[model samples]
Target: MIYQTAESINDGRAFLKIDEFIKNNSVYVKIENMNPGGSIKIKTAIALVDAAEKNLDLKNKKHVIESSSGNLGIALSIICAARKYNFTCIVDKNTLPHTIKVMKAYGAEVIIIETPHPERGYLGARLDYIKKRLVSDNSLVWTNQYESSANREAHARLTARELLNEFPVIDYLFIAAGTTGTLMGCVQTVTEATPATKIIAVDTKGSVIFGTPSAPRYIPGMGASVLPPLFDSKNLFDMVQVSEKETVQTCRLFARRYGFLVGGSTGTVLTAIRDYSPKIPAGSVVVMISPDGGERYIDTIYSDEWCLQKGLLQLQSSTSRNTFSGAVVE
Candidate 1:
């Protein structure tokens, strides 16, 4: 018999039963939202901070800068505060006030970009600000989560190990991609350990990470306008994309059925599992990664008013799976 407990938020292990939610006996979800910082971003944030400390970079650096307005910003703020390092977050208007407040509450300085880039929008503007900051100060260290190998390595070493310990023979694993760090890291470790496990990368419909055409993405967390360097086509056994509308519906479904209010990206992962479950082998152990809880999204994804304004309210309450395209199943 095996039992799981999160002794500390940093334990990097917590799973919830998906039997009630998915109606699938073999499916389970690792709840990464249970982490101390309220998301799996802490895993990589700690890695980046520790790496800086190891090389004496943190000693001379007066501040740490990151181009994030969501989970990563909050995670880094918490970690940096504990280590006595000043942290700055570059955000845009699209970022939720709740996220910015949380980061600021942890002593992080928030810089909001008033103008959006013509092509890439706020994401591009945030990156441009980071570049300017780097040029202005030599003591500011930037932990570029998108291209940082440490980001992927942290999930490979910590998050994947915890899952593998619980289910050594996992048959299928589904993960939502943002920076692609979590997806790439989990795939590297899980595939190497359980050679037959099928790894699936889930992304938002507007995200270009999986070669989908770029479009305006209202949803945050799972999609990237720019393809993250950590993304490897050959590493994944399958891929899936969920639209913003479908993602909202999945979040509502989980809330209604299982009382689990997950983040937008988690909804995307669950949507993929429901769509692909038909082709999955019987009695196969499947794990879907839930990146964060939904409390932080109350003002955006979970708000009835916001949903209505974005035309997502009409899509709610329907949990039916949609036909998938632009996906590779192997």
Candidate 2:
């Protein structure tokens, strides 16, 4: 059954299911999808724009420009549309179709850049181009999501506060590291409230986050080739590197088991949880953050044929039937 409930940003009671998961295992999981924008980026988007407005004279600003993989762009587009500010997003060539459509629907101009390398895909190049353009046009406000302190602050204030209130006794948190804002925010909050709580950061195998080799990542939101300035690795107790295959399998499992169609990064978190579960003391708790929903990846990870073509699904010789190796478990 689809768990339908009115979403609330301020209500701690609404997150009881997540809290129960934390309590049962001895850890707390904070689902930031409850944010108004359908992802944790909503917190960052609000803070980024608000900070820009406060720092710069916005009375006659012409446009707000930013480079993003998907969610952050969508959030910024919505904020700009509602505030009547012209917004422009420079996204990678491979950005999801639905994400592009949603940004356009919000009256934001979308610029898709074909990145030189198929792997890096315009995140850095597009930002460099935008910065150059901003130099010429002083009216444009550049909201650099990766290096933005406001993004980190949003997670620290809103997401962290909600988690602490919902699971006061949380002992460990497993988070997929993207731009590092969410993890950094959680780290800051947990350090202040529950000093003993341990934070485990998860990254993809190909991501250069922990000085790993750079490889193309199928998963869009999490993992970065370059260490994001916002990531304070010292605060994290440990880090786990999840493979793309594991991420895809976990996402499918979450859908089948809990009826939660989460995205790739969420799958990585789940994989880490399973890998680390046995080591956790029996009475201790563990919580993982699922960053976004799976509707955006309908033609990709959520599709069986797509899975087969990607080698994420294989045929069993005995039965002559295709089956996924990673079965769903609640």
Candidate 3:
């Protein structure tokens, strides 16, 4: 298989018209899942590492550590392996089994935090562990994806440029918010390049990013118990929150209609698009950024047993699917 350099993987991805899934002719989906690391997190991961190298933060540090649910951890693992640096990923229990295995396969040490923070839950606990480790180990460097400026910089410099190049006249840009890196980065770039374009931030209902109450969440890539530093509401054109059940339903719809299996976060984006479609003007171009594919979620979002256990099995209804229709833009 042909591959781009880790530093330039952003060049390898392209937008695919998932109009059939959107049931709208003008909407387009950028499948960031095609990134070698399996998610858009690869962009920020490379940016963070590059920044560290430039700042001499990794001068004497042979060990790199970061707190992540999945995607970022795997991205770092891949980068560390290619750069000949040791990597340690501190993850919460909600992280999928396959994600940990992938990180390990790339020569990363995985640390699972069993306990959840009383207020912030798993994310807090994971961050707390990294802080403690950082104090004791002078050689351990943390990427700090949550608060790192480089996180947002990567998306602005790489991702946003790609989107604008593909569709220079975007009317709406729909993005899922995680650590707010992707959201903030793209917003910064898009708002400046296409001032008339609307940028919608799609977050999970239980996420605290938009000042919502935090709850136990099973989905990995998006939604955070604590507010991310990069999140800036003033820049967003609008915000939409989708329930986990709705997210799963959308994922199921994509699987049945498009033969595509997208992650929980991508499902959230799709759900937002459907809910917000009526308000969107006709003939306007809409672009949704899908962070990753659903392959890693086969045990969770795509599993019948898992859905049943979570009381989400009944959410799979075909009635809602009947309301939609489109054609692929070949």
User: Among these predicted structures, which one has the highest TM-score?
Assistant: 3
Give the per-residue Cα lDDT of candidate 3 at 221.
Answer: 86
lDDT of 3 by residue, 146-173 (tens): 9889999888988898898888899989
Which portions of model 2 show Cα errors greater than 4 Å? 1-28, 117-121, 308-312, 315-330
**What is candidate 1's lDDT per residue for 188-304, written digit by digit as tens?**
898888889889889888778888777777777768777788989797888998888778877766776678888898888888998888888667788888889988887877776
lDDT of 2 by residue, 257-311 (tens): 5677778788788788778776677677566676777888888787767666766
The TM-score between candidate 2 and the true structure equals 0.87
Instruction: Give the candidates in order of TM-score, highest first.
Output: 3, 1, 2
With a 3 Å backbone cut-off (N, CA, C), the pairs that clash in candidate 3 are: none
Pick by lDDT: which candidate is best? 3
Which pairs of residues collide in candidate 1? none
Residue pairs in collision within model 2: 25-285, 26-284, 26-285, 27-285, 27-286
TM-score of each: 0.90, 0.87, 0.92
Query: How far is 267's C-alpha from truth in model 1 (Å)?
Result: 1.0
The 0-to-1 C-alpha lDDT of every candidate, in the order given, reads: 0.79, 0.74, 0.83
Which scores higher on TM-score, 1 or 2?
1
State candidate 3's TM-score. Answer: 0.92
Residue ranges of candidate 3 with Cα displaced over 4 Å: 1-7, 20-24, 315-330
